[model samples]
Target chain A: MLSEAEIETLTGVAGLMIPASEAHGVPGADDSAIMSEIIVSAERTEDAVRNALAAFAEVGDSSFQQSHPDEAAVLQTIVASCYYRDARVLVSLGRKPQPPFPEGHEMEEGDFSLLDPVRARGEIWRKVD
Target chain B: MKTDPIDVLIVGAGASGAAVAWSLADTKMRIVCMDQGGTPDPTQFPANFMDWEERRNGPDHISPNIRKAPSDYPINDDGSPIKVVNYNGVGGGTVLFAGHFPRLHPSDFKVKTLDGVADDWPIDYQTLEPFFAINDRMMGVSGLPGDTAYPADRNNQMPPVPLGKSGEALAKGFNKLGWHWWPSDVAIATQPYDGRAQCINLGACLWGCAQGAKGSTDVTYWPHAKRAGVELWEHCRVSQILVGDDGMAEGVLYFDKDGVEHKAEAHVVIMAANGVGTPRLLLTSTSKQFPDGLANSSGLVGRNLMFHPYSFTEGVFDYPVDGARGPLKSIWSHEFYETDLDRDFVRGYMFEAARGRPPVNAALAGYEWGTLPWGEGHHDAFRKLNDRIMAFCAICEDLPELHNRVTLDPDQTDANGIPVPKVDYTLSENSKKMLEHSAARATDILNAAGATEVHAGYPIVYAGWHLLGTAKMGLDPETSVVNDWGRSHDVKNLFIVDGSVFVTSGGLNPTSTIQANALYVADQMKRRLANLFD
Candidate 1:
């Protein structure tokens, strides 16, 4: 249900966080349509908090749906939110979180081995904010 | 009125039943396994972890096992004579187990012999050691080896799950405190062993492991048995165990999925319907010869039920520590595993560093922010959730007493109109004492690990996980329904092979011990069969 851009971004983040290769032989974030599938299958649906943020692509850009008519900005927002939120959940479930850092600092540049941010970002997104 | 006959009839297809069936696979005798739940294809398991998260909210959250939908999934505690939490399909309790498998210590076997309290297990751990090793390999357990608490001959292979932060932190703290701890031995396959893939750290174990990394009998033992020519009847509820004039099980009467009665006769019947279900079935099957209940001559068929007291306490850590991302249990501490003279409790407690998946955390955080019924109050609660790190549960041992019992409710019945087991239970003085001691120690460990707020409590009333001791095994026929070999003392061919025959519950989870015991009994059953035929 998410917009193409938001889906792309979320998948991009999932790719970075989960990575294509890990201990479990790569549970790819990009291939995970789990959120989208769940949203479509719901008996009744509501706009989740994260979907609201997905309306703006990169802050300055118009909503992904407006720029690309075929896109589902609201859905993308919800999916991204749902995905990230679960990422946060993965954190609480006992995985160590990645260290927080300021923007444009090369998200992957930290000492990831000791402090895996993918799991942390996933935990933060899991929050209701 | 008429009875059909076979060699071995097994009930319930969970870990216990599956292991028993697997053990009996090589035998030429006809084997029939039955369960009251539908067999779900592994492919249909949910991919979304959020649905799993909501599942922890109990019946209120989105889960297929919601009480309104399935009669079997209900946590029936309606002031009945027996209260229990049971899963109705293939794999039984193994379907919902967190895969935390640990062997009950040798001291656990001789609790009475060593501690001067409770009844001693007729068979010691040494007698069951070979079976334990066999089951461990069959289940593909992943865990570190060489604990002094365990026998030297026991296998010590560790599972592939790298230790998580909580495990590391707790291990470090325990080392500093000189406490015994180890990476938990889990049924989850660490690597791609036995055709099952390794765990992806989905952190959603209780809702059922979709990845199949967490070993349940459905994936491990049952399929192999089925391949070797064992017939399985899913959604078939066994109602009565029919006995012959010679005091041997002649056959079993059960209702199929369509509510039609079907009879399967067996020379030897193994009751693996778990601690509660096994006793419930026995109590329901009252015959003319055994008037009180089938195999209830001692009046111990449904008595002496024991559920280990479970408690939880959490520690708060600085910064956002993502603790909800892997199998529920990754590590365990048995620092206080044995009886302690310094404490008032008879048995020790096992501490586990476990994961609480996201949706559960969200529900715990008190609903969504600014959403009606959940305003800023809820938002603030959600904000602080990430800073929590927890040393999850400490299972304290509870002694088997005659007073703590399970009985069939005359008024209540399952979908098939059979009486459900009503649980009439209370924490004995020893259990309460053990719980208090474990809670105090749990709080101390949390404080020592720099936890800001430590919360501790006893097992929620009727929160049944490890059902045990309903049909206990003992050397004394007057006190137990089954003998040391799990064969019924009263009936010649009926065997009780689940947790129901346990005289005492160790601080550890019951899955490994149950599976081991089942294998041992199955081996005995094979020998008995050869002797009868030859």
Candidate 2:
């Protein structure tokens, strides 16, 4: 539902939200395909969304990105929600890209020994008077 | 909805309805159940695990308004902050529940006697104890055998599910605070029982269990109840209850999948619909004998709607807490379960370890609560928050106020052309005070557990899981709708056996108690078969 120009604007805005970190190997929202994924979740019509993006993108690159907090927040939330859906992003964050069920993640059992400390002190339940 | 002449006709095949059918399996009575929702399609649920993003954001979202499937009847919850959370399928809300099975304490039944707020339940915990034991065994409960925090009982069938990193951290905080912390008793089996498989720890119990590990009634009770000769009709919407000229329930009139009207004549009619649904069904069933709606002589059909108000607080740790592996609610604290004169509120709240949302949910939650700020630093901020956070949800006890209620919306109707339910609810000052207190305490516990940051939010729209106290049980016909055994006071053959009969919404989860009440009421019905109407 996004025009090429609006996609460019969204790409610019997404970078501002979570800029590409070369040091950490994290892709920016634009290059990482988060804006495309965000388009999949857009509830608004293409004309309305494009028009909204036009005002922000026209304001001299980073002008509206810094100035319009409402649009910035709206775009940031959408992009971030979609950004986590990317398997590459998930792996970089040390998370599995797969869905949580059917084949569930295998977690290492916690130090069950840590519970002994609490148990050693005896029961802590207050008596019913 | 058309069926043979039935000895007992139950309106819902949910947690309560399925339990009642199973409990009465040995009686060899001709029982049939009518449900608006079909059995959950595990293949289409989060179980199939594809379209995870769209399903979580759209079709499989917890609220029926978003899911908007054919089986779900739309509810106008525009008037309330906590939107209704329910599923229409055979298992009912249990299909989407977290399986956090905590029983009500003895004090929960005596809220009015102890704290002078709300009416005391006609029946007490002592009266429901045996039924609770029965339900625990039937549902395959898992927990430590003798939790000192509760009345000593071996009702727990299996050892507690292993406490993950989040559980260990939260347990430390509770130990440090010297409060009562125990592994929560959940309905999900850790080991195979009664022909069901052990839990594979699939993260989305609320999204429909694919492995049949989680104890949604369709997988648990309905299978056995059906084997015991109880017929379940899916896509059967009961539009009204027919009352005979003698002021007794005759049968139910319902609509089928093709909008064809059908009838099931029965001697006894049981309403196992949830708190909101049970009353809405009754309010729509107006007859010459019950012009004001059947079994509503007390004028309490849909009044006193109580959903446990909740607050969520997440703690950020330097280390990873991959809580997404096991059941969502494995550990909890009853530290604030009792009333204290020092607090401004009459009752208390519970602190449960909330875990295991996907990355999308976690990101949305972090941003919604303002822990993860937007702009250039957002990625790093979410990085610090994502899988490294442990959450604590304070489930507050809601008092029954006469003004808070569910009523029929004149402007809205479902696909079957029945008027839908409209909720009018606002959090009470007592609950608000309790939430503030509970949130602060939760933050303290998280901080003590060595968190770098703690985030808290009030009145999120998704906290409407526990539906209770609409058609409640009591001793007087003038004051309450149902009597001690969940039989309607005005109509002898009519009964309500669900969370709808709850006198008060306790701080803990209500499903176990809902099932326990169903079992007790069914047993009472069996004993009184000779003179059920007397």
Candidate 3:
């Protein structure tokens, strides 16, 4: 579990990673619901998450992004994993928020005449007995 | 304890095992198949959950060492550059395959005769042509079949999958270059057939098809084999093949899910444990008669490993190609599939166009490549690449080398305490040359496709999907492990019907040919049953 102070620190960092976009109508990773999901997801790799957070805290949030790229990437992965799955974010990307099935998307059948050139090339395989 | 002896016993209920069992079901003889993995549940497939992308990178990973399911055995692949990827279940690798199905060309079967390279297969493309057609119908292949790259008479059971914007973009590139591109033959149901639903463009074929549209052998052949009275025992891991004093196979000793040991006796024992697992089992089953291994008089049970050396280049377009909208594999090019004496390499490669990555994967990949940044500009960078990138993989033909082998691990064992397989492999100079050439050609195609940016990576470390040629087939018992009909040379009642019997690892995916070889071997078994023991 994260203390209130750590959560606040994480919120600031998340906002820096992905700020709220008014034009796209999508909340930033710092949104409470998304942060809650990220915190929950952190439990899967608790040690690594804690280590990354500690590293960021030690470096201080202001210079963390500049001084520590590898540590920031750890937090980036955690945030992205949860943030991309959020309904608003998915919709902003023009994707359905729900699972891919039992309602799948339709695809357009492309033009087969695009292969006229290939077809005109004739048989290219070797003749073997 | 020993069970009653059956007419035939098959170890591993995977692609080849399922097909062989189904093909031999008409014989009316008592048959049994043992598989280590449990049956899959469609409701629990990753695509059914909102976190499908996360699951694909996690529990549903293609590498068994990473997935670590109870049925999966760990492979010690640290010594090799390429890692082995597999699914240890009823459907085997088919369960997680992208279903880009293609048959070996006629020239592939006679490599030694034409290219003066690896030994030629005892059987040719013509011999497996009928069987390939049979498998196509059974698997419900979908494609537009006048591909000039292959011989005449190649047909598809259904119309081709939608090319979508990504495929069309790549096809235009190939057309501009005057190269050979075709709608790839994929083992996915475009329309309803064989009791499966049509593909709904879930774009999650590699994580196990949630719609039951991909032709995994569990759905394609296991159902028919079971209906024909072929008993399938799941969660049963075979430890070794037991041989009688008369130098014949006497079934296998295996462990059930409970870790309890049991013995299954049979007149004939068929090994379909794939190239790695099959050789691992053979090397582990050492005895007084054979000494080295069962049916290993040629000392070639676990030698001559081959994997299609893989490379790819991704092109990023300004507009949305919607590359993640449909099946993973859409179109392919055979322009460089055949060998040319003028080239530096002996055999050639095929160019397979792949769909873009899922959103999460796309973001992660961008970060890895240092394109999508961490802070201020992450979203913009991601938007520019997501669904706008198209990738073309070069599946190069790797020649069989005796030094590249799968041997018994000196230390590690699986959860069931069975000795695990250790792989020792190195990329040959020929393969390296081929990968370099293919990457350059792929860049040309991507450039022709009007891409704003292109990135290429060679010798993909995670692409050991096509495991083959560890125990090859040939006419001479002194050189090969199995005979022309997949029968063992040293052990009369033993047979291997998997990729282990492949003499050459053709550039294309091997599942179609693997299943065809299995059906052909089954037919041969039936034709010579009266004199099979001779």
> Against the true structure, whose lDDT is highest?
3
| Residue-level lDDT for B165 in candidate 3 | 89
- For model 3, the stretches where C-alpha displacement exceeds 4 angstroms are A1-12, A58-73, B1-4
DockQ (CA atoms), all models: 0.03, 0.42, 0.68
Query: What's the best-to-worst order under DockQ?
Result: 3, 2, 1
Error of 1 at B416 (Å): 0.9
Stronger candidate by lDDT (1 vs 3)? 3
**Ranking of all predicted structures according to TM-score, beginning with the best and ending with the worst:** 3, 2, 1
Candidate 3 structure quality by residue, lDDT tens digits, B166-214:
8998999999999999999999999999999999999898888999999
Worst 10 residues of 1 chain B by lDDT: B367-376
Question: What TM-score would candidate 1 get against the native?
Answer: 0.78
- Point out the worst 10-residue segment of candidate 2 chain B by lDDT: B49-58
Candidate 1 deviant stretches above 4 angstroms: A1-129, B1-5, B43-49, B58-83, B156-160, B357-381, B530-534
Which of 2 and 3 is the better model by DockQ?
A: 3
Docking class of 3: medium
Tell me the tens digit of each residue's lDDT in model 1 across B119-163.
Answer: 889998878999999999888888766544455565644443556
